[model samples]
Target: MKATIPVYDICTVSDGHQHPDLLTERLGSYLKENYQRVHQQHGHSFYHLVLFTGGSGSHTLDFTRYAVEPWQLYFMTPGQVHSWHLGPETEGYVVHFSTAFFRSFLANPDYLDRFPFFSGQSPDQVMEVPEKLRDAIQSVFEQILQAGADNEPDLVRALLLQLFLETDRHIARDGEPGVPQQKQLVLRNFMALINRHYRSLRLPREYAEQLYITPNHLNALCQDLLGKTAGEIIRERVLLEAKRLLTNEQKTVAEIAGELNFPDNSYFSRFFRKYVGQSPEEFRKSLN
Candidate 1:
């Protein structure tokens, strides 16, 4: 298979200019006169929060496609591959911000790891925004766009936080209720650790050890919250990266296996097939 999915940083789409720490724009305009690029699978170095206020379509993250409608919101974290196909009438607000912008807002480097929406543990990435709340969210996005013109980074940062806070409230209200906070914390920590060490560590026990929890405890937490064992969660992360590499990078299967720390190509092939339902080469070919 050819390398069809390229990982793009903000600069790559901005005429080779450096990406601003935070930026906002109308979704339709940002995609420009030709909107087909939005349908191409790609990865980003920045986080994306897109709110659609008109029309309908679908957005795919990893291998799952999500339905999108007016007044719906979607979040995409850095390193996740996503693509969209929205109707031509679609109108929305899009906010793009870097990791540095988020880190500057809070002392904790992993502050974003706590968000339930884009985190790997969450299955639902799209949230239905209440009609009453749309105006407020729109105002915040407009403020961020205007703040950019004034070159006020601090103002943009503050408004961005407000937007996120409001979105969080809506998500919490609409999401599954009565999930214990302790279970949420364990899942969050597990996702954070996976993001940090997915390439070298493939074992659930490794993550459990670092979190100072027993392996069984970690597995139980995952089973309760995500309906999967801790090891399955780890493999899910690994499989995501494996698919990304197979589709984006030019490396052969064996080389990719070695880079991902698999002992041999066969071992990697078996693991990939077990979770993804196809051999690595077959998966790559199917992408064509």
Candidate 2:
């Protein structure tokens, strides 16, 4: 058997929403209060901005592990599985907000697509805030907390907007500057489409069709930006979902394969072994 991954949702208590469209809390207090929920393999229904001020440890996103240290900020989009292990002395601020919250502030509904780090295709998930900007970032986070406390909705929204713009400046400064704007837009749209349809649309040609681009052009774009063909990108996404499903013991291998739209269980096993270096059963056993 394998451990189940929990998906957490937070809500703005002031207004009753099933899922939290927006929330911000100090890291130490939030972790201490929700101790059981803090250190676990879980996905969220919203985006996260975790600002660490002290202590150290490590965090794992999907299968990749990263150091958890002070002066660094971690951002996560909805549906990315992650877990963390931290020292007892760890302290920080954590902001949780949904795309809807951000959409209300901008004319564009998908403003996050314009931010490189928000696009899942980027390898950059954690960014280190420069020492000079540390104070400024902390101040903004404090204001957000204060606004939440005062129940000032407009102030909270404005503060969050300012925070996102400042963080965008940091991300742009650190990201690859030479990638052309048009290519970036294309790649971003392609990635968004994959996230939306990866479970059912396994073909690069299909994705290209949805994006209104030729398959060859999409392949070239993936190769240029991600050093992988469009097919590889699609396969990687399918493989990631496969791994996530394998952790759910309630779902049999055959059932998981069917849900992923594989032709058959045997074919799914072969594909899993080809990319993951292990059969479905073996992967589950190792986790056990």
Candidate 3:
């Protein structure tokens, strides 16, 4: 029998190019058959917004899975382990860019604060754009593809900012009144710290102390807006990293455990099994 390879391991782009900017307009038609993009214990470090224009499939990002269908938009943030099981007839346009791209547009460290799509919220708020909005998105891509052959950084940046703003507008129109700005700032800081130290700092109190807030307050705020405790958020972040390491990297469980600051390999195995419902090795085999 032929072996099924994992998607991340094989460069999905044609011409063996890895840069997202270069691959922007190119359609990756072979992604459906080339790999089983599984969410092993460790996740990824890039953000992708996949827009499904036709066909059907199922996608899992973080802990939520959605049935993919026509005219659906899915947001996959950095540090989340996600997988897409495309139908035999799946068709879509995907816009993939790194956080570095945002830096060029916003030019400030706090720029990410403008967008809620990156906040790691559950039931990921992916809006199904109306035909009008869809047309706008397509037009941006058309302009991007037609803007002279030269590398037009200015045009590219403008289109990207427009895309993000449009996404933000949709989110605002759909979402309930979010947490207050001060509290949101605190939560954003807490999230950033967790992203930086998820492997080492597994406790909410660890982050609370660093933020100079009590654990109880942090938990209350997270519970109020996210419907989960702060500790649960931390666990999700840790598990996301664990999934990325297990699926995307070649490291052994013991090596991953040590890196994540688990006391022993067995403990990490138990943690992975509890949340992922599979042993680390079993998850890796499923991807293969």
Candidate 4:
């Protein structure tokens, strides 16, 4: 098999100059002109968010299909597989930016990852704008639209930060009651650590050590909030990466196993099959 899925870059030029590592556009015109690119199964190398003010449809991200509606906000981190199908009337605002787009101005480069919508968990990445805040959020996107058109990178970025913060604030207010703030921070930090080290640290104790919590406390935290063991959390991340890597049809099974740091192809296949109910090749074949 050869590589089939396209990974898009944040490369665009406006007028006679190359635009910075960001792109913003109206969803209607964007899909109208780039129908195939938006509809096809592909990945992007930038952070993406879309606010749907009208239309009905569904979007698939990382193999999970999410039913979309008006006043819905969807965000995707780089490298996640994506595709969508919607009626012609669907319209919204889309903003795409690379890591450098924000990191250059902020001291902390991974600040956006703190938002649950940017967590890369398929379900977590989709948020429905509350009725009262819909208009406010729409106003922000409109400002973003104008800023993008004016080529005001600084103003656009400020609006982007505002949007992210507003969304995060709402999510926090809507979260389950009784989850302590400290516990929430610890869980998020654990997730951040997992995202950075899943390729090497596959043990609950290892993560517990880094988090300054005992293994039992970490496991209890996972079960209380996420309904899984800390070990399972780490393993699920590894499995997700396995699925993502298998999407690259150019890679052989052995090569993928090596890249994932598995001892051998057989070990990787067994692990994948145990959880996924099929071998990696079968999973990949099903996608095609």
Q: Model 1, residue 94: displacement in angstroms?
A: 0.9
Per-residue lDDT of model 4, residues 248-276, tens digit only: 89888899899889999999999999999
As for TM-score, the candidate ahead, 1 or 2, is 1
Provide C-alpha RMSD values for all models, in order.
2.6, 3.2, 4.5, 1.9
How many pairs collide in each candidate, listed in order?
0, 2, 10, 0
Q: What ordering of candidates by TM-score runs from best to worst?
A: 4, 1, 2, 3
lDDT of each: 0.76, 0.78, 0.66, 0.84
Provide the clash count, candidate 4.
Answer: 0
What are the models' TM-scores?
0.88, 0.86, 0.75, 0.95
Off by over 4 Å in 2: 1-3, 11-20, 98-108, 120-122, 172-175
Residue pairs with backbone atoms closer than 3 Å in model 2 (clashes)? 10-20, 11-20
Per-residue lDDT tens digits of candidate 2, residues 155-233? 8779877877788766543345787878977887888788778888888899998889999999999898889999898
State in Å the error of residue 160, model 1.
1.7
Give the per-residue lDDT digits (tens) of candidate 3, residues 126-210: 6576777887877776665454134565676677677777776654332435546677668778877877788778888899999
